[model samples]
Target: MELLSAVPFVGGALGAIVPFLVVLGIVVFVHEYGHYIVGRWCGIDAEVFSVGFGPKLVGWTDRRGTHWQIAALPLGGYVRFVGDMDPASAGKADDGDLTPEQRKHAFHNARLWRRAATVAAGPMFNFILSFVIFAALALAVGRASNAPVIGELRPELAGQVDLRPGDRILAVAGQPVETFGEIIAAFVRANGAEVEVEVERDGEKLAVPVSYRLASRIDYVNPGMPASRAGLVAGDVIVAIDGQPVASFYDLQLVTAAKPAGQEIVIDVTRDGELMTFRFMPDMVERPHPVTGETQPLPTIGIRAIGLGGIDPTLEPRGLGEALESGFAQTTRIVTGTINYVGDLIFANADPGQLGGPIRIAQISGEKAEEGLMSFVYLIAIISTSIGLLNLFPIPVLDGGHLMFYAAEALRGRPVGNAAIRVGTMIGLSLVLLLMVFATYNDLARL
Candidate 1:
């Protein structure tokens, strides 16, 4: 902590890089292991299992003669199968010099199905890793209880509310609510106005007045946004903006939205009972719509809503089966959303600036690590799912590209020619490098 304070930029860089390496390293290892194990199962021996590319930083040859190594670069990894010209398996190695036993166990000599499975396994394993982590998280966090009972409330209240913890919410705005969802709907119907909340307390039913909108407590702060740059963090309560008193998050949003981009504004916040002031010029930012993937430019100091209106719901522990189901659903949602965003990018409907590369990922990783262990782990699952999906894109030099070749071979009943394979590999490598450069540019622009 002292070192970070002494040299802020250097410390921040280290913080970001360490977590990024940990996350990418784990994902890459899992992906490569999937290829190695499946290849071995299909009578194809691996010559090397590398966690990165370029010269070996550290390595050891196992009993099976597979050189397991961590290479100099930390960007990506590969599994080099026996009788492969390179780690990418773009062409065949010299098999004439191999012993009879070695020749039979060569990857190129394996059955077509075996080869396809080996290439596909890398992505498949990535999905499996994400699934397991998501499932475990679901199990750990459990599910929110359906009953309309307030388990807890935020320590700081923006305004007076008659509602209290342990109150069993019976109705909202004179409308009976059987579940929490209905209560939320009733609040929405109130539309940022005060509403009557009927609650049962100490065996007595009573009416309490509550605000429809939540207090202006920061729930989430985007890492590179104006709020974060100005040193605002989650849990800080916005007390006022430009000397105008602010109560609800809605008010904060409305004020921020109305301010012109680059207009300087003062924000007063309460953190741990101490009032602090911040001044910054909020920038106009573009982000993809949650459901649409189209770019939407919104004016703001970036902060996300808490979504619960200052009330905490009760949570119920989930069984393994239920947890797994939730995990699968969550993973599927991420995969679909990513695909949609990519589709939008291809159609030019999305902002290219939103496309992040390693630097952006590193920034996020560091931020999440600071948030807590669970947040960091959850990020890992998300990145794992993304890596798995990315490798499945039909681009040469990727797992999906290999599978594409295998499919073509299946159709033609002959392997793709070495010359064609080499050309495709070169094109794929160029595309990947270009993409990295573009994404890095985006990251630098944000900085």
Candidate 2:
């Protein structure tokens, strides 16, 4: 693996494609299995359960006569049930010689509710998988405590400050702080200057003067972005931009924004106690506002701060219930945020160019994997949630579309006409294909 990184294109492709396949395969399998299991419970016999499309690479028939297979393509998967015309199960099979007993297990012959439930199960399982992953991650990492306590100081702060882990911060400068937010606000007010911090350490209160402007230290480097392309990495503290000293992350942001787009700028950073300089042109792109979901053109070097006031938060022990609750909230937030973004895009309030495809996802997966296992897992949870929510959109050729047909059947006392279903499916397929093409174009443009 180390040697592979020395190769030009081969190294990057391997790094990205492997992680991408792993994430996609797991998500697709979970989704398809959802349909398979639910269809089985509904007395429907699955003829084939596949984790991909195209030619079969490997397969085995189970005792129930269901062929479980992995296919050549890894993009998506499907469950072909009995009485399905094809793998997509878009239509019923015309097998005249089928026994009545066999017909009873046919998916198309199943009750309307059963079919709907089976279709809905795919997206449902995706959401559940995301929730489980998020909850597990929270349990593993623990949650940040509410108090303004020091968990661990940044390594750069070593010897410069006497703050220790488990120390409860009482005040910054002269302002007393009761919560973590207050502590951050106090530091921000200090404007990156050295301030006296009062802390309760080992049952004794002590005042320690410390510089609270470590937010300039990069916590994340966005893959394929200006900073990453220029060889900037996390833990590198950006000290100056274009010869102007930057004392905080906010200052760095200001300098970047003030610089003209596409203009080459010099960035001085300190990494492992050594100063280094990098020159790069910042990208001007339409990015979604963090709070509003509205698009605005912004100049960014693509570095991120992981925490407020440069504090490495101490993780507080979390119970199972709390972890699950946090997971639910996180999943809910992503769903709503995505919905808002889609709505904005449709209304021309958001940037459609920001829509990404497989390539972008692969790049992100590779970058996060390089960061750490937990970061990669977190990305998986996010992508899983997105996939689940997307499948729920009421469009043809999706889980939502099938549900729409079921609703019509329930309302009209019969299934929608075959002709109408075929047309809808065609339109849905076209839309899906167009979307993929457009998103891929965007990905290439980014590159």
Candidate 3:
């Protein structure tokens, strides 16, 4: 009902809400269930198995004495075990008051291996859910994307480069490129250099020479500006402005911003590997900023840049296993590439604005969802995989952290001291918070 009210004009609001809620609920339920089932198998009694996190909304106790409930917060859920000093703690307080039989069933009293397995199940379940969902989607719809072979080349750059349309990009400089997106990203970050691009053509690898050009001053259109009227898209690599070489999108923007209204400029762009020239006179537009409510002048661009094709749709569709394998492989490559980019940013090899958070996720999710259900599902799969991997990071308060502790305990024949866990938890929490803040700042800056 609330979902219907949220989108009154859309007749399928209920339908959409149902699927969204079902998917989210299922993921949370499975994760908690993993903990509960493993704990029970380890002879520990689960006091409660709850879906969601805040105040309890509705629940019931089973004959086995496990309270099953749905909480108010839908973000995450948890399972509480008997004699758990803290819901998530690995150590227990003195249980002298408890009967010997009850004490035997305490979570902390369980074997170290059992306790480790219980903690590890939550994240394992998350990954299992992701893999299953990804595999199913791939099997049902088949992954969609263009091949990495060059389909078109910009005329301006083509004149200076020897690359051809059929060439399959293998690597940029010395780094291997697994996808077209990765290739473009690497190209942009390289700036101006005599880059060596390795390509495969006619079964032979060839190195192509390319140069990166750094733009002078770049100007971003404010909330309301004449540039917006002429049409502009983010990521549009502007090559020329007013018959002058612009080098980068920023250069074109700076030149236009300095010119007054009613001055027409010729803009040359390499959109989707095609060279096109456009003439536009910017008109100033005004809009209230969402955060400050202050009126601002932003450039208006009516058209957006279209990306070049890379995915090959002609490949024969495969079965579930094959599809799943390919999906996993592709996801792994993407994750690795992203990690490399993060390192690049840290070392000042990449721009920090490429980082984004919830705002960007929502923007992308909304846009992909609008494209179709399949596209939306693909986005979800990518997000799910990313989340699964992130949770596996060896940071305290994460599944991987518990596993690390388990390993230490296994080797030392004793649990790590509480002081160590506390310190690690603090460190992990601080790192996560810092990352969130940085991502949020980047999101706002882009706006």
Candidate 4:
């Protein structure tokens, strides 16, 4: 307590919480503003525009009879349009008894398309905010040059490969290449196999094989298994296999599977900061495919990679064209990757314990902010995209679910029955509460 007082502003837990508050404030402000503005444009009168909930700290009634206020809590905001049942937009069963003037301005009485537009605006604004942020970020930092010139060649591996600085990469595995992204794509597409790359140096073009996979760590070795018998220990990093670069566990699987079982393969690994090469013959084993659920014979050295460790994303500025291209590409990649991860969890292929609540978000927010502005902005863009995507899920109470209801209205030429809405709302609220409870548990467990 004394230390926190001495630090004054942004001290201790307050400091950590600041980043989360700022991020949430920005997202909430944008989302609520979308609702407010679009509702106004659609001729729906908003009764209140409040930042936060609970007791009001400061407030003013506008000339239009709208109460604009900053409430006690700083967590989230809401736009309470006229005729709402409380501020949740839930309709009352007796709303039809309102005066004609009130009914004319009621959101429930608005045209179907207008209501849909107002409801969808929140997530749409989130996506727009993310796209703009990403585009601006591109202009702030210059991007790495696409020319095949080598910069810093990592030690140990550099000496083994016949490549040098100032060498321009011409092609990889017979495919033409021009950028580092392309080079990485080639490596991933080849799995973990070595590829011959053509290079040009001082007017002389030469061909050199290079393996550029990120290091993989062996987390487990089956007892008395091939890997264990060969004296490979857990925590050993397998940077290369059979002189070929090893990128990921999947890469390790692909390369080893391509080889006939019982064939001796040289494995290069690093343990305790020391490099060691070991000889081992992989055993043929049947592993179930993720998609087909069928077991296929694949060679394995009886080792599995834990996961990637300590990856730092690098950002560079680029030409207007390139930057714009990268901006869209990165956003799309994040969206697709998030969908895949969520899908995996739904299918029980992923661990539910990985889910996190607001507590974890605050921790991550502080950590990313410490990494610097670019990284923090990147984090914001990612979270914004995620929030937008999450709200679009067809869970009953979400924006997507509301849109689903609107679709039904369009099909049936009538609003969803009040009884159905009441039941769905109950179910929706339950699911949301369950999600929060589950995620909070995960966060506490992690802590």
Candidate 5:
């Protein structure tokens, strides 16, 4: 319902909220379900399995007597096991008064390995989800590969431009490029300005003038988005933003990103050789940073750019087996990239603004949805991996922190002093709260 709302009031963010909530709900349900199911297998009785926190909304008691419910706020979820003093699953003190049967099924009474396994299951599930999703995407969508070479061109446009199959694109708008990605990037940097493309054909390079073509043009437009609402059409060539000439699609990004959200700006475009000028406010949007996994705000006109002069394929699409292989490799790259970025942030080599919280996640989820179902599913895997990695941080109030305590217990050959755990819990909660506040602040600033 929230996502169904009209465009965001100030930043046009209202629609994003729904997709964000959907993503959060799925992840939370998967996480808490892990804890609940694992505890049950370990002979620990769970009192409730809850999605979200705060006031309860709808629920039903299962056959095993565990209350399953959806709460009003869908931010996070939890599983409350028997002998737990609170919803956080902290152990109940001095369980000697409990009946033998109740004590037998109590979480605190479980073996050390069992307790550890139960706690670790949540993050473990997240990792598995990531792998599964990645594999599925690879199977469904062909693995990305190869350089930009025109293997084919649309029949109509093939006559308009001097392009042909087997021509390897070497540069766009005079920007040297090798791979398809670089070619796309070059086009983006051109925005809407007419340019030239150099290609290698028959061992000889030729420069083709695309003076009548655009560097970047709209390919997709979501209804109610800034561009669509402002009367911008797909295929429109953006010539300028705020009177400054745009040379590349990336120019649009630079021009808008530097401007504050909700700020009004003039845009000049030529559609079918008819030049037009329009004034509209750029919407402030929060999205995940590509490298850092942090949330940052950027201005958007709500348009996706398409390849301008056309494209040629140099490599064949990979088969399912190859796709699966590449998919796993891709996920690994994401993991390593995120870890490296986080390290850079900690060492003061990177900006702290690279850290984003729920808002950032939500924004990306919505944008991905607009891209297509495949993209949205891919985002799910990425988010799942992020959750798994975050939970593994050895801080209190998280699975990793609990594992740390269990490690101490294993070394000491006995359970830790309740006093120490209580202290650690407090410290962990404080650190977690601090992170939330900081991320929230960043989100607000971006909006």
Candidate 6:
């Protein structure tokens, strides 16, 4: 009976493994199958369609003679074309002298355009997967909770500007504002210009004049800090610090940092169309150096300053076209943000702790999946989008690399030489190995 009871626990554990593996396998299979299908369509012979990598664990051969196999590693899969020297090769030529019939089926014998099509299909499938998933999610879930609208305005600023909570901004400085993001971006870019602000409030459109004020100081509180304990959040613009007028977040930070620890400070904030005040004492936090056994004192206020702005809620939900466009726009923003964040870390401008690897992704996937089906679907969409974007990067072993080679071939009227291919392959292989090592190290460090 005890052994029977344990079966449920064992089954549950096995069930957990199945979903992760299944999802990963499906994604990789779709990517590789893209190449296989396109290659066959172009009349090029594909020798193998294998899932995962490393040593083969299971195998089967189809009537067409394509060897299908499941490998030990579950990371990714690939399709091997006949006459291809290596995965990265453009299949410039078949080194072994073969019969005329065999030569016709060789990858190198295929027209340049066909070969390019085969290589490009992998990333193309990834993008198609992303778009379809996004469209389906949007159609099923409807739009995300409508973009935040102007909830409240600071009394000091309110007196100067006639805008109120629930006012929908139509445009700023003559630029059309379709979403809340556009409105805030326009406001910041205007930077105190005598800009014309058009808004819709209570079904009435109103035009108002507003100027941007140069930000002086910005205060960012660490998460779980005393400020958060006092109900302070990231977007709360501190209009007053310690009952003193503050121009920017910096001014608030400077004053709070200069104040003695445990001194109670009053902070005034405009949030979601309401004015609120909070009293809190800054806690002294210690930062210890890893190399040196030394510590530094820093103010602890748990919260990060993203930006200060009121969102206009009067904007209506977008149509299908607009929603799809917004999805693409969001994807672009995510890619740019990721690159910029990575650049920041490389230059020591940002914390390295933010970097994560496969383990982190898996943990996030599990957590998000546990939240609900919608959350899990959203995670899949994001991963698909990221995979698409990453494959588009101009790395030699990636799909983009093949496209690069094709472009060169088109320009030069011939394929790149074997020597060039060999060098590029070596460089690409080295880069991939190095990145995997770095990612694994980062993952382990977090653990």
RMSD of each: 8.2, 7.7, 14.9, 11.2, 9.7, 14.4
Tens-place lDDT per residue, model 4, 187-232, is 5566546899898889999988765544477765542245654556
lDDT of 5: 0.68
- lDDT (Cα, 0-100) at 158 in candidate 6: 51
- Candidates ranked by TM-score, best first? 2, 1, 5, 4, 6, 3
Query: Model 1, which residues run further than 4 Å from truth?
Result: 1-12, 156-164, 185-196, 204-212, 215-218, 221-304
Model 6: residue 240 alpha-carbon error in angstroms: 18
| Best of the candidates, TM-score | 2
Model 2 residue 257 CA deviation in Å: 16
Flag regions of model 3 displaced more than 4 Å: 1-27, 97-102, 143-315, 341-352
Query: Which regions in candidate 6 have their CA more than 4 angstroms from the true location?
Result: 1-20, 88-99, 144-323, 339-353
- Rank order by lDDT, top first? 1, 2, 5, 4, 6, 3
Question: What digit string (tens of lDDT, one per residue) describes model 1 on residues 34-73?
Answer: 9999999999998888887778999999999999999887
Better of 3 and 6 by lDDT: 6
Residue-level error in angstroms, candidate 2, position 255: 12
Question: Between candidates 1 and 5, which one is better according to TM-score?
Answer: 1
lDDT of each: 0.76, 0.76, 0.59, 0.67, 0.68, 0.61
Query: Against the correct fold, how does model 2 do in TM-score?
Result: 0.79
- Predicted candidate 6 versus true structure: per-residue lDDT over 97-148, tens digit per residue: 6667667888877898998898888766766666666666666655533353
Candidate 3 similarity to native, TM-score: 0.56
- Going through the candidates in the order shown, the clash numbers are 0, 0, 26, 5, 12, 21
Over the stretch 324-345, how does candidate 2's per-residue lDDT look in tens digits? 9989987886787567658756
Residue 289 in candidate 4 has what lDDT? 36
What value does the lDDT take at residue 137 in candidate 6? 65
lDDT of 3 by residue, 76-153 (tens): 566777775554453455788566876888776789889878877775665666666667776776543446566666
